[model samples]
Target chain A: MAALCGHGAPIALLSPAYNEAVTIVQSVRSLLSLQYPAFEVIVINDGSKDATLDTLIEAFELKPVSRAYDLAVPCNEIRGVYASPRLPRLVVIDKVNGGKADALNAGINISRAPVLCSMDADSLLEPDSLLRAVRPFVEDPERVIAVGGTVRLANGCRVRDGRVVEIGLGRHPLALFQTVEYLRAFLMARLAWSRMGALTIISGAFGLFRREAVVRAGGYTRGTVGEDMELVVKLHRQMRREKRDYRIAYVPEPVCWTEAPESWRVLGRQRSRWHRGSLETFFRHWAMFLNPRYGRVGLIGFLNIFIVDVLGPVIEVLGYILIPVLWLLGILSVEYLLAFLALSFTFGITISVCSLALEEIQLRRYPKARDLALLTLAAIFENFGYRQINNLWRIRGLWQYLRGSESWGVMTRKGFRAG
Target chain B: MTGGLLGGLWTASLLMAASSVLFMTGLVIARLISEAGRARRRARREALVADMMSAMDGEADAARLKSEVREPRLVARALLELSTLIRGRELAAVTAALTQAGAEPALLRLMRSRNGEDQIAACEALGLFPSDKAAAALKTRLKRRTSMRVRIAAARALLQMGETPDLNDLLAAFDIGEVHAPLELSAILDEIARRATEAYLERLKSSRDAPALRAMMVGVLGRLGRYEALPVLLGAASDPEPSVRAAALSALGALGHPDAEPIIAAALDDPVPEVRAEACDAAGRTALAALAPRLAERLDDDEWLVRFRAASALLRLGEAGRETLDAAAGRASPRAMRTAQMVLAEAAA
Candidate 1:
């Protein structure tokens, strides 16, 4: 609806590109085709040694432009700014190599709109997703500070003209397992927290924010693997300190399709990095844990994170090793062992299945009956081996965090299928 | 030895897992069936609509097709969809068809439906049929304390019906103390400006107490290109609130009227950085060559954005402004020189 009228508030789509020469052109083209009346696409070329900047310049027919912007947030040096005379809404920024957080800050500083949509360069947003994601801000512009949309795996979906033409479950078992995992994480967990008014994290893949709010909160925190979650937590702390009433929303209808890691090594690295980021964000803001001053966000929100992420891995891994040894040594009874196995294994299968069922009943993104059945099987099969391997990865992440490992492991993607 | 309770618990857990699997399968099957049914209904509706359109063109029996369509809501939607594509005599023909099919009464009935979506759709559809009954029904719906969305829809319908609904009545529906004014309200204001600019200008004159609302109104007026509000906008440029002043300066910039040059020039020296930024933008938009020295002086401003805008504004000027920027590049402070050089490099490229 906002596409028809010029009255919609201006928004800036800020994407950080790093060595993504393969997908950069398609992603940028998709962004320019978003169904919004007033918006601009700001793609930050984050010092890629590859052909990211050159590919963009050649593809867009870009030329240097005299644009004025403030360094509202900290970022690296900018080599130059380029714009195309043909596509006026597109602007490219070439800056030195900084992490994703630094690149986002560079884009924020250069952005002129009051609202900003931060997304990854590899992700593809549905055409109407921006309008749907920005509805909360239009409705209550004062109180809503941020919003996140559902992130679906784009592994096996059909792509046409840089859009997901058909929704298909990825054939890879790893990708299928992640499809179920993401459904649980976004649909159940995020929605539950959002209803309590204590949503802590908006995924870095796709989130909308009030420019002034993010700028006042000191932009995205640099040198953190979990910059997205950290910035949201920092916003909560700042708003609570100032005694301001604000909301961090999660809208499930708007979908942003992203490529999930397919191989075991890459998946392990991703899981570990995610766990490390969670630990880093947790310890960094430990004072908010059970603190009354931050209200439900401190008491309920941090408690959930502390139990599920910070402590869940260590206990699960210990149970896996120690339980069998104890039973073999006659220190624990066989009945008790069977009970433990039933609770851990069967209960997990139950949760994953119900999550898949909920997705089918509600969203129906998986249209084919065969794909639905395959996903259902994946949900059940994941509990046996995949879930155990994931716990081990998270435990490794815990160890990495303890050892002060700050590396973002190399993540490789088989590029999307051409139209 | 452990009791049998542990054994029974394991058995129960296994049973629970199996049942949940079955439950998921059942739900999936039900959904598939429901989707199929929905597809069937959609196909039937499309066929019926096509038939009705042909009837309207006299290729088919109009009375028979109208009576054959059982779903009033479906028929009403079809007529409304057809209304957007035609004009004049065709629109009149569609209206006659809708009345002949008794769609107006059905729409009124839907307006009173309990479902919020039904009510909203009814309100929107009624906009196409401008009658006293539809207007009265929408006004009644607006008076009720409903959701903001429904109220906004009702108000929009009233406006579309060429009725000058009270601005205060709409404003009363929203909480006044909110920091950021709703964009939907701005959209409504834009709609009102199309038909009744005086109504918006009148509200602008009286809305000083609420700075956020005042700023929003100023923005709306500017976007609508209502040059008649130039006097009000110029006065607002010196308002007590910085946001209002910025909005006024921005509106003036958009207008680019020669009469507002003095105000724009004075705003370049405004106390607030944001106001000065807007003033710089206005200077560039108006292309006042005489303000080149003032613009050059702003190149040394402390704020990064101000300096950047100052340099940009200078480039918007002609040869004299370029000479001033070149001088700044040669002799100004490091910050000013850097900005000037960047702007000059870009212009050269």
Candidate 2:
């Protein structure tokens, strides 16, 4: 927010990139152009095989610097930290290959600020996003560990000058479904949860975190598919255990537009990875389930997570198959099975539509009126195909987990074409 | 013999109906059996939840607790129980379980669902626990959402959280001084919930997001009676966006600002009916006597809401308004008469 310029706290942007020669410059540009005055850009070059390191150095006119490292964060090894020869506020880290998590860690290790931001290489942040995100940390010094900005589907949205000015629906149905899901997910689900004071994950693509809280929780867990969720959970565990006052917040207006999986292959991989991350996080924190000593947060919050989120696909898929099959076999009656299915579908659609209506009542972002109509249709159609396909991917993810497949596969990125 | 034959035909018809009934009953019975199975599965899930809840009184084993109640419904029930615990002032254990459970993407996905009661329940759970996960989800739920239940729960949670970014966002998003945030926010926090403070800070942080944020900043300044934001509010009053300007005026009026009189008076002539209504409210809020004549002009508006709004504004003018309204009422001009009567009653009350 322009109003937040010269105000709020200093924010350090961290982009841990590997082989992202195509989009690192754009990402860095967005950070440098932030509306807030106190922010400095930090880009971690995680041993990219391509000219990712050279590209950033050349573009920003990079120079090396000996930076002291006491940010209270536990992170991967860093090769060296650099600052811009032209723009001193811009910092770069040339780090060994540690993947996204490692690069973020290195950035965290080198950042010199109160609040830290993590951004994906291909993501675009609104100029005001940083101020909007970090304001929580400054206002409530005693509490407030992290804050998440809204993430929008960038596949169809027009991007220019490293910013997304106009938002649009995706061209392909896969991207479209994801777009709707992101809207419903962030706009509905995350908003509702944050209001409830039980936010678990601050997405890695765009979020601000307190350096100490994150470091105390052991920075980003290396080799993890979803360090975002893991870090949040770890933060919750530590903060609540110490009985310290803290919060992970959500900001509605500060948006980050990132590419979604536009094709089936990509969607499948993304969904599977997400599922794996969830499973891994669940497995690690399994002890907190309904345990009162951890108080309401542990027993209730984690318990709900286990039931409503963790094992949702397993029961859902089984239920879908069993009821229909049993009815066809003259075991369970067709009429009854249909009724059950209809009730589930009806309720699901009702909720989705209501969420759509909420969007209309509060933030109507899609430029066209028809977009709302289309989104509503998308909500209805989701139960038929999108939900099922995702369910399939989730179930497959579980199956893979059972087979001890821990490695995350390659994800396609068409990269943000100049919109 | 003819009567007997007729009775036999009726008997046959009754028999056919009885057979159809049997078939239908048979179908229903079979359905019941399957529902029982699903219910049994649910029961198993709930049993695990019950155990987790019971065991959670001591150590937090969210990972284990979730193993028992993996069904969203069961989890919803567990979360409901969890909400009660948090509501009861016991937050630590349940929050841990919530975090542990939320790690499951499906549960997170389901909990994030807009319309599901289970989603609402998860929101409630997060509210009780006051964890990062819950806070994040509830904040996201604030925008472009559907369910009032979800929204209310989210708002209540943030209200409980106090002065956080989410609170700030909510204040920014929903703070029209004339229109409050569902009235639930008023009752949600007695003490300054840390989360509320966080929300307040967040709003201040993102106050540049236009109408919502600008309007909220003015409203908060007006409601909290902050003189510091006066210039900002005045600037906002003449904003290019009518809604933003009106919001600023309305906030100014609420704060009883003398400076907004001309703007409020001018807004009475706005092209938009809503702007006119807001201007009328602003006039009442500001107690701008100069706008009384201008406000009377709206008593003839085609829109009944404007007439009422104008009447209300006029009512603040005391004897002057009573006289104008009486003239309209006496004349039995439909719009003015009805609005005049209601205003007279409201003013008298």
Candidate 3:
């Protein structure tokens, strides 16, 4: 066959970091090792109280540079800009504490590439991920505004010099359960949704976008907790309103690896924040809910997010509490209860196992049969208690959302085990 | 009646749970078997590739090499590996050997298969063989298949074959109304620009094409730096559509042709701000000393991008332009002054 094109288009990779000193250097190293020919790495140090900036400066020999940036997108004030003489492609922006969305906007302002990728500071990208993720942009430059790839859990993986050296199931049960959950969300639901041309969420861990489209959509909104999802929805709304053809794609390959919360406390905070963000985004774009003007995005995608994602948890939590009471009051039959439990647990396990199987069929990161077996066990185990607890967390998040709480709780991380 | 209904539900649930468990077990086993099979196949292919390489170095008989790697899949894999590592006469020899082994027909059959996975794999394999037959099969697939994956594979295979598909055919395949990933289109266009510049130019001359299509082709021409197409591009610069004019101006900038300077300078007065922005960028790229004054005037363009590009163009004009920007930074309109200061700060860094 013909030789692949020598050089793909240039890309600007934006990673918004906050108090991530432990993983910042490693992440930068990984970005440096990407296989794409033309790209730049811009890390927005979002006023981290930790030594994130110091670590980056020391690792890359960063020196302050008086750079010029057009404030096309609104963002917080940047304290300073630094560039490494040693690694010319690496740029760091020291900005005030403006959350993830604001940091991304600041990076977008300074980015010069036609294509931009917004990613998390703690996520590690596969060497060929950019090359693969960039395929869609090269194929349909006119309509494809954004593309997202599957994000896998890195909690159990072996790392050496910022690369995944080996794949294994995490020792932590919570981490294992999260791994299975991620597989289901990314491999099955996302692929199906993208095929229908109604994919809504491009994980903030790693999403590639057309620079012009993002600017036209007014960049990431400041107040939304789900900036990533909100930006995608806004892009959909904007492009549709302008009567332009566009697509938001989801690539099934595992392009990004992130550390999942290993402890229950951290996991609870993360899930609650996620649920609250979903609630806010759902309410914010309520016009699209069942609105014919938005087409499938409104009718199918919006409804799915509402009924399945937002409301399903509430219904499940209520069932958990009310079912036992009904049984005691003789309003529910013992046989019916047994049947419901069997169906729910079995169906849940079946879906999770199928997702694992799908992963095994394509881009099998897990190397060992034992790892697959363990993941399957975790899928079954999650249905027994973990899933219920997650539902409870969503319920609590709904309560907080109703009460008008807007706080993003702190999340502690145990840094990757680097070689 | 309620008791019977409950019993039926319980039985159904019990059966479902059992079947699901069995299904999970079956999938696990199937995965294990598939993994083992893949490992074995990979090892065999690796060994065959090693032998093929040695043979190519004149250490073994070519006939023996072909016979040893007789399996169609193995032959395709070996050829793909060799294509990347060797070129010219060595590559021709490998291709000839693979063709004699019936690799082309085998791949063509696979390309026509109903299985999507098999079809994609065949497209990848066909990229190694640049024959008329391979190109025809790929083009047929491109026309016949509506599956985006199949179409992409076919297009990539045709590009690999070094076949210059008609620009119209490509545009038709990449319908504007249909959502296609930009990266894939860019790659195809880049390949066509690199290998089939003449065909692209021919297509660019057709006024009958859609504006979006013409715009894209013009963009490709610019990217290819086809200096010979300067006259056509200059004519396109005055097209009725603003997008076409903007694209043509961008191409002129990319081509960096000094002769286009007069035309580009005239575009500064275009009604559309986008066209003016491209004109300003082109001025910077060509860096005509005479355009520096004109570019300086544009620093006051109402559009922020136009002003930004104007200041950038002036900076590219060396000492004279820098002096102009300095004056603007000191006493021009607020927007112009801010733009000049920003450009100056960037230059200092």
Best by lDDT: 1
Candidate 3: share of reference interface contacts reproduced: 0.35
Writing each residue's lDDT as its tens digit, candidate 3 over B50-135 gives: 76666566454557656654466666656666777898777666666656656688878777768776788788779878888888
List candidate 3 segments past 4 Å from native: A1-9, A240-244, B1-8, B11-19, B61-67, B89-198, B207-216, B235-246, B262-276, B297-304
| Error of model 3, residue A229, in angstroms | 2.2
- Summarize candidate 1's per-residue lDDT along A1-419 as a digit string, tens digits: 01111256678999999999988998999999999888999999999999999999999999877676767799999888999989989999999988999999999998877789999998999999988888777655447789999999988998877899988878999999999999989988898899998899999999998887898888999888888899899999989999987899999999999999999999999999999989898999999999999999999999988999998988888888998899788898766777878877777778777778778767888877777778888878898889889999999999999999988989988877665
Best by TM-score: 3
Q: Please compute DockQ, using alpha carbons, for every candidate against the native two-chain complex.
A: 0.30, 0.01, 0.30
Per-residue lDDT over B1-349 for candidate 1, one digit per residue giving the tens place of the 0 to 100 score: 3467776777779897889778877876876787798798787678766765664575555565556445556655665677677666656656566666666788888877787767777787787678999899888888888766777788888887789787766676654565555557777877776677877677777754366567777776678776798988998888887767888888887888878989989989988877898888888887888899999989989876678788888888888888999999999998889889877876786
> What are the per-model numbers of colliding residue pairs?
0, 107, 21
lDDT of 2 by residue, A1-419 (tens): 11111135567888888888987887788778878867788888888899988888789877666553433344556777676657978888887887777778888767756588888877888887775676565444336778988888888777887988778777677776676688777878788777777777778889998775777787888888878988888888888788876777887778888899777887898888888787777778877677775665577667767876677888898887887688778887555455455556655665666566566556666655556656666766787978988988998877776676767787778866566
Pairs clashing within candidate 1: none
Tens digits of per-residue lDDT, candidate 3, A209-228, equal 98878999999998667899
Estimate candidate 3's RMSD in Å: 4.0
Give the DockQ-based CAPRI class for model 3.
Answer: acceptable
Candidate 1 lands at a TM-score of: 0.87
Interface RMSD for each predicted structure? 5.3, 24.6, 6.0
CA lDDT scores, all candidates in order: 0.83, 0.67, 0.82
